[model samples]
Target: MRETLPILRLLSLALLAGVSLLSSVALAQEEDGLDIGEAPVIIPADPADAGTLQPSPSNPAGATPEVDGDALELDRRVRDSQPPVMKGGKISPDGEADQGINIYLRMGTPLPELPPERPFADEPDDAYGAFQRGLFLTAVDKAMPRAQLGDPAAQTLLAEIMSRGLGVKRDPKGAAFWYGQAAQGGDPAGMFKYALILMEGQVVERDKKKADDYMRRAAEAGNASAQFNWAQILVSENPGVRGLTMAMPFYEKAAEQGIADAQYALAQVYSALKDVPKEKKDRAREWMHRAARAGFDTAQLDMGLWLVNGYNGPRDYELGFRWLSIAAKRGNVVAQNRLAHLYINALGTSPNPVEAAKWYVLSRRAGLKDVGLEDFYLGLTEEQQKQAIDQANRFRRG
Candidate 1:
């Protein structure tokens, strides 16, 4: 399972003055199962136990014939089963009955034959390259030969192309098989992709336990996407499970690997959990800063808020306004609303009705629904307000 770092950590500047505490947590287990900074372990979510789980096809609705109490009792008796293990002289040292009991040998079973190595060079021409070059059929054809030869890379590419309908009709089942083959060959990307299908219940039955297993395998193999996915699952605050405090390590790991989305997610997590200790806030701010620097829209918005309000540090309105403006211009409704609020209240900027009206109109058009801006503009003369509203509407429409 993935682990997360503390998003709400506060640290004294005296201790962190010179050094940049830009450390990121990795998804892998170190020593004890706990993540960085001695955060307690948080168990990941079980896909099968979730409310969203769908009934298996084998147990399809109305498939099971109803029976009277007597008939059910008779059926139960007929289907009664016993545990495979038995205690007594048949029991092994590890407990339970031993299936590998060997009277002829002192040790356990012999090892299997080593399989022949298939070099990476045996992979077919890059299907992604061909696809990028707009040669869908050619890429698929080239991948088929390597797929037949059991090259995991080719199999994965073939699966991706088919699933995405890059060159042919979308075939999720076909994609699933190819992904499974590549995963069996130890390709992390294949495992990740295949696990996504299982998790999403696409073209096949959803199996959360299987999906979690595959995701874990891929994450352990250093697949950034898998690591991120596993971390997201483990970092949730679902009922019967501890909060995301335990998932920070995995988030940090994926973020450290330079996954833009992970960075953005970590930043958000930290900002939301800012109520933790001062050290936690500092840690959260660190992640937010990293994500903001990387140009993540959410991170930019959050970092801007932090800077403008001095939530975790000294106020820096210029920096905050810059980041907010960036997010706003990029179509972030929240950022636009925040900017309008600043304009209206003069909290982090000078009060300018025209500018405030512009931000309010932009925010409103972006689905923010800021009624206050409309009210404020209505106080002016009809002609002035009309001009302002028309300008704002034009900007919003644009």
Candidate 2:
């Protein structure tokens, strides 16, 4: 019996590895409610509760969440189930009512991830290595001799340095010249930048045909940004499920290369298109989770509701609450409002009126009005209100 006891102990320890485990033990645990915990709490989506969320409140944002923004206007019933619409180069929510379905263009703020600057990607020579180390001036000096001798890779290095004004006066025209030379020399990064310059017309000339050619070439050559943009162009030109089908490959490519925007777009393609296969639709949640984890706030917001409403799979209210909390912390107004709902209703957490009010206060200050949140505030005690305000103030100071 003692000898057999050690064998059992060893077997139990081996089960912890998960692979080649004892099925009987697993079955026992399953029957006893083990696994990744029980099936999550689910809130069914009522289709009748659609197209009623009033996003974009008229009031300009205040410095901090206020007890009162304007008159008590309570257009606060949030809903899902709105179809996606192709509008103005964006796959937007059909009515701007699905709080998380609105996909904004990655514009105005420049994405720092564009134009790969890895010193070791190809030429790990001193010049490229110098650029990697923030020695931009040194990079230019070492790269110039090679650049003058018509080295396209070196030319690309010079273009990136000049364009970003890393260590020298910003000379976009000079960068354009270098980029053009590199493009001619068959550099994918150079081609992508040159294509953008041509399209912008301000940096060079607005030759869209030429720009399109260059972009296509760059995309085919495997520039992640070019791949994503090329997909957008295909959608804009074709404008339907056919266009989406054509562009899916490029979006997949870009998403695989860690482009968060591309990941979110892929999710939208799967979810918004009714013609998508059930297997492919299942991928929407996966891609959305990727985008959200990559810090795309909108994706995070959507992931929260999707999990709660079981849009893609079974509900997991705990994870949904977590994602919504993350977006709320990052200052997503809609998330803040929705998170308040979660908190007050005890969807994924214990009902804490104070925490709910705190989140609502943040959203209200950001120019979003929620009548339900207002009523929630009115119901809180004066002490709870002060505590909520204080909590919000701490978040503000940070």
Best candidate, lDDT-wise?
A: 2
Residue 56 of model 2: what lDDT?
14
Residue-level lDDT of model 1, residues 1-398, one tens digit each, is: 22222221111111111111221122122433211121112121121110110111111112222222221111111221232355433767666566553432446667567799878643234565575556666667766666656667666777766766664666666777778777766677788777877876856688888888998888787777667667666644231123345555566677777665566556545544434456655676677778677666666776676667665566677687788878777777777777766766675568777776777767776566645666876666776656657867666311
lDDT of every predicted structure (CA atoms)? 0.57, 0.65
Judged by TM-score, which candidate is best? 2
What root-mean-square deviation over C-alphas does model 2 reach? 24.2
Candidate 2: list runs displaced more than 4 Å.
1-126
Return the lDDT, model 2, position 214: 89
Displacement of the residue 320 alpha carbon in candidate 1, Å: 1.1
Query: Cα deviation in Å at residue 96, candidate 1?
Result: 74
